[model samples]
Target: MQRILEPGQIEALASRSVPRLRLPDRSRVFAARAERLGALSRGHALQGYLELLATLAAAQHAALQSLEVTLPNESRRAAARHHGMPVIPALGEARSSAWRGVLDALRTAVAAGNYPPAVAAACERLATRSAEALDAQADRLLAVEVAVGDAAAAPLIMAALQVYWVAMAARLVADDVGVPESSGVCPVCGTLPVASIVRTGAPYAGYRYLHCALCATEWHRVRIECTQCSATTGVAYHSIEGGSAAIRAESCDSCHGYRKIFYQEHDPAVDAVADDVASIALDLLLTEAGFHRASGNPLLWQSPG
Candidate 1:
């Protein structure tokens, strides 16, 4: 199955003249929060993450100022040698200094053999800084796109954050929503799901799962069915050595598509993007099995067809 959108077609569609989407107020807010979180997450070990987040937030806000339309090339690669590098790493000496501080704080807390409020406080402070930086960068990107008449850029950037925020929010609220017997669509976001999980332990066992792409939430999909074509025949599951039984990729011969599933009992901290990045081998295997992904990741979308 040809799951990915053809780049040339997408580019052609983007080039055609059309009215831009007017993002809703709620979407704008969600975009801001999501951008902030993304930057903060990037700087998990560096001090400048918070600043990057803030820059991204500002970019969204600025984009909203111009009728909620984003600039084209918002997703474009930077021409500079270090374009698209997260601001935290780009901060050079500042990043190193901040990392050292974080390490020292963590070390001291560990040696104390007790949770240090200061360590947590410091982390929060750094997160705030990253958020600020992201806001600024976001604003700059919006400004540049608008000035250059590239309407596509704003939406691309906003879309990236929207996906991230929705995933995070979905995860936080997954349990509240009832799990289905089988399905791949997110109950909350109504977006195509990325993975499914078979959890172990009481109350979670025997239930099949689907992970959301936008909000990063996992919900239950009915077991033994193809998420794309709803066909059960020829469905197969595979895993790598040392892989958690809770998580595996479900491949559908009928549709020639596959999605990843995660069992909560396997590893509680399994983030869709982070874990997916780490499990490229599984993806490669699925590809070899004549299956392809139905959705795209911002990081992986650049792959050649």
Candidate 2:
């Protein structure tokens, strides 16, 4: 007869087998993403927007280099751990206002880079906004209130927020993070995943980690499960017929939601964010087929028309 383990026993065994968190590498995460976006832009239908995001990601890398922020104090972290909450929740008063400065730095860096005239003008317009205005937009972005935030400025504001949180996540000791009750959200910042990646290499081979859209933190989750509703029964994977085998949309019939997942085994260079952005057609088809996005990409903001 086969034996089934209880939840606590399963947790205990998985703890020994799987890595809970893969913290962001402040040095190379954004840089590698920028390079990947640039590479994906060539000969693509969304070349202009991809190129713009490439520049924005490069700016994020520059801002991340000198950016500094304080992590939650031991007391806060302890309290969070006790409750199985995120160590550095992006919402509420936990986030540093220094993220505004990171936004300004990104703006300056992006302005210095080569971009289309309209994009340059948009940067100038964003620079003219008051701190309160920027904060309002940022609040909307962080809270996933996408309908009202300035679509033109959301990406820039989000980039700064990313650098702010990534700096903290990169500095975090993975062991310090609490065991989250749910695997759908980021354990570092409590944000939804941009996408999941089946990574290659020792220690993480064949393992799926959900990439946080905000802080770049990656947390391990078992495959073939609904990341949105955590439904295990009706999860399915979809991809473009005859397209790149590396990326696919993981759809859940239970929740009618979907998220893209990348397989590094098919294309070793597949990036969670970059490849997700480069594959808009898959998202369109899934949306048309009645599945909403399970999570959002930082670089892609949709405004209601």
Candidate 3:
């Protein structure tokens, strides 16, 4: 079903709004994400794949429990104001040990054997890279991300590293950043969003925010407009005929782009990555209709749309 509204009522009309600032509780993010991953794995269309992801999420949670990171006191204020590209890559240069710790843990997780052999090989290679080598590799992967619209060109291990590293930077810099972001891309790392969430809680009712694929940051965007082009016209939503009402493809005629929108009201278990990964059927439906996605989930390494 399609939903449209007059242009003036939405946030995009503001043209320059503040980033919906948030700092993830490192202690809670992984565990909560693990739960969502588990649920998706147990009862979703991509069950086997989701189960592997669930394990990976749990591993990430464990790694976070022991991760040691230091945040700089300086803020990203000037950069935010100018919409400057993030100075930090997903594999930030600050702590080589921190990156190693995450990669090492991911390698162990991949070796545990539920996933395909290729995943195991990638993690092994990831674990062997030196910090200097990894830095160059990170740049290459990011270049590919830019070229392919976050497609899974890099291995899953690298995607995991991107999320952890970028998330750490975003958290450290989040408080210092201010109201200077109103674009479709992430203000923190300049990455496209995985998907948008319409939260379930009363305080967040009707609020819509795009979840960052690399850094796990969520920034608010208007509900009725096309996230890809900020178009208010020719926007329609499509969903599986008998599936949950909360999830749908927000399609735009202007850009012919669509992104998945998850309504937490109907599915509190919804997660930016987990739900997006589980909904392969919906993606197929939208693709069949010639609508493309603007961004993607890191775990799935989806090509645009």
Clashes of each: 59, 0, 1
Q: Encode model 1's per-residue lDDT on 1-305: one tens digit a residue.
A: 77777955874565343211111243445354435345435634432333333333444344333322111122321221123221111112111122223223323332333324653443344334443454444344323232322222232333344433332242232223332333444543345555665655555555665655444444544567787888879888888778656558878888888877666676654545434544667888888877888665422323233
**Model 3: pairs clashing at backbone N, Cα or C within 3 Å:** 293-305
TM-score winner among the candidates? Answer: 2
lDDT of 3 by residue, 170-233 (tens): 4654544444345687656566788999875554566788887766767777678898888988
Residue range 126-217, candidate 2, lDDT tens digits: 88999888888888889988474568777888888888889999988887688788878898889999999999998999989999999899
Model 3: per-residue Cα lDDT at residue 89: 39
Better of 1 and 2 by lDDT: 2
The C-alpha local distance difference test score for the whole of candidate 2 amounts to 0.87
Task: Judging by lDDT against the true structure, name the best candidate.
Answer: 2
RMSD of each: 16.7, 1.8, 5.4
Ranking by lDDT: 2, 3, 1
Could you estimate the TM-score for every candidate?
0.44, 0.94, 0.81
lDDT (Cα, 0-100) at 280 in candidate 2: 98
